[model samples]
Target: MQLLIMRHGEAGWHSLDQERMLTETGRHQVAECAAQIAASPWRPVQIWSSPYIRARQTAAIVSEILNCPVEEKIFITPEDDPGLCLDALLENQHSPLMLVSHMPLVGSLATLLVDGHRRGIPFMTAQAVVLDMPVVGPGCADLKTQFLP
Candidate 1:
């Protein structure tokens, strides 16, 4: 399976954590990233995003561009465990999936998939990483590419 892990775009700070919305720049950033993805060989069958407002907004843009369905998943929230996220992926039968979530979770998920550890790679806002996995397990995936907007 191929996984596209993305950090939500830059969000405004005035709202409650879960309610924070994306800034104008954030929308542009995600749109640019989505455009690049649409031009690539990879095509997402489904997109799962954190329930947070920012993440939902980011997913909306991606779904619009890719013409893929988006589902809000509780397991992809900022504070959720990376292992649980992996388990969720394992439960899904779909391939070429996209996950739009937050920092720490996104980075941690990548580390857990590639290095078998929780130590996370740094992710800038609106950054994305692609992983090629034979199965959903620790250290089973290889980093394919990274997209920054």
Candidate 2:
């Protein structure tokens, strides 16, 4: 199985963090990253996005580029628990899946799968990483590649 993790594009500030929308630069960044994935062998067949506006927008851009579909998942929000997120993810190990989420969550989830801990590595906006695993679980994955904008 393969998993792709991505951070949302750059977002404009909003009083409600969830309401923040992507900036033009953010859109371009996502486009660049999406194009990189489209040309790669690891393009996702399905994308799961945080319900936050910026994440959904980022997923939309990648969805368009890869012609993949998106599903909004509430457990992937920035403040959501990574353990819960991992539990939810376990039920969907059917194909190449991409997750579009926020800073801490994206980093934490990636590291949780790849390194067996939540000591996350940094991920810039619109950045993406690919992980290959025989199964979807902690410490089961190997980092395959990363896309940077």
* Candidate that would win on TM-score: 1
Q: Alpha carbon lDDT of residue 3, candidate 1?
A: 94
lDDT of 1 by residue, 25-56 (tens): 99999998988888887778899999999999
| lDDT score for residue 124 of model 2 | 98
Model 1: lDDT equals 0.92
The runs of at least 3 residues in candidate 1 whose Cα sits more than 4 Å from the true structure, single-residue gaps closed, are none
**Per-residue lDDT for 48-136 in model 2, tens only?**
99999999999999999999999999899997878887897778854788999998998898889988999888999999999998977
- Cα error, residue 102 of model 2, in Å, equals 0.3
What's the TM-score of each model vs. the native?
0.98, 0.97
